[model samples]
Target: MQPEDLVRDHTIYACVTGSRAFGLATDDSDTDRRGVYVAPTALFWRFDKPPAHVDGPLPEQFSWELERFCELALRANPNILECLHSPLVEHADATGRELLALREAFLSRRAYESFTGYALGQRRKLDADLRTRGAPRWKHAMHLLRLLISARDLLRTGRLTVDVGAEREGLLAVKRGEVPWPR
Candidate 1:
């Protein structure tokens, strides 16, 4: 079967991600879609297995096979974990709903490392950008702070929330370069 067909016909979970999912979207924000699909059992009988991920039939879209998605989620990959918790799910079969229900099972104390580690990496890049460019890219700086906040809240609450909620304006201020980096 065609790869796109897997996402088209076999997808079990799909949701909006990126700035839009975080409630930080502006008029120019691009819609980033992420999803998980279960390949038909029959397809595995062949020597060539179904792909573990697909890069989209639409612009800025990507999907992982269910097994791969689960593996990443269990490892607390920030992106995959956030996708499962996104407030805007576009589609979900019974399996997808089950996946949502199982979201909490994927969380563990280990996320403190995974999320913070990811944020730390981003932070270094932003620092380097500032050193070389005289200013960090406002958009990347905005996202780095957002990610650091998300990691802190997740570790504190044992819950994952993507929306900036009340912090939206402060973050938007950062994005607009109104907030100084030293602050």
Candidate 2:
């Protein structure tokens, strides 16, 4: 079936994500939407299983089938795990709510691996940017710090907290490029 078909007919959960969901949108921030959809249980009977992920008929929109999302989250896929924790949920059905209830199951010491690995990957790009442009992508650096803090807290508390909570102003300062990484 088409990606749009799955999104329209089977979407079990949906949310606004990225900077908007982080409570950190500026006037220029784009709205990023994300979601999970569940194919009818009977769809599995077909010889060809549904695709694990789909991109939009709408710009900047994407989705994963429910089972596929869970599987990837279990494997410590950072993007999939973050999708489960996005604070700006726009829609959720019974199945979707149950999935959210299991968010903790998806968390483990494994995040130290996935989260740090993601940070390292971003750092490389920042390093390259510094070489080419004489500065790191300060915006990406800010988010990396935020993500590291989140991973640290998740490891310490065994809970996922998406909002910056009391760190709002500090993070905003970082986002605004006031907190530069050492050169």
Best by TM-score: 1
Estimate the TM-score for candidate 1: 0.95
Q: Residue by residue across 53-149, what tens digits does model 1's lDDT show?
A: 9999999999999999999999989999899999999999999999999999998877878888887787888888888987787887787888889
Instruction: Tell me, by lDDT, which candidate is best.
Output: 1
List of clashing residue pairs for candidate 1: none
Clashes of each: 0, 0
Could you tell me which residue pairs clash in candidate 2? none
Error of 1 at 5 (Å): 0.6
Each candidate's TM vs. the true structure?
0.95, 0.91
| lDDT score for residue 84 of model 2 | 86
What is each predicted model's overall lDDT from 0 to 1?
Answer: 0.92, 0.82
Question: What is the lDDT for 149 in model 1?
Answer: 92
83: Cα error in model 2, Å = 1.8
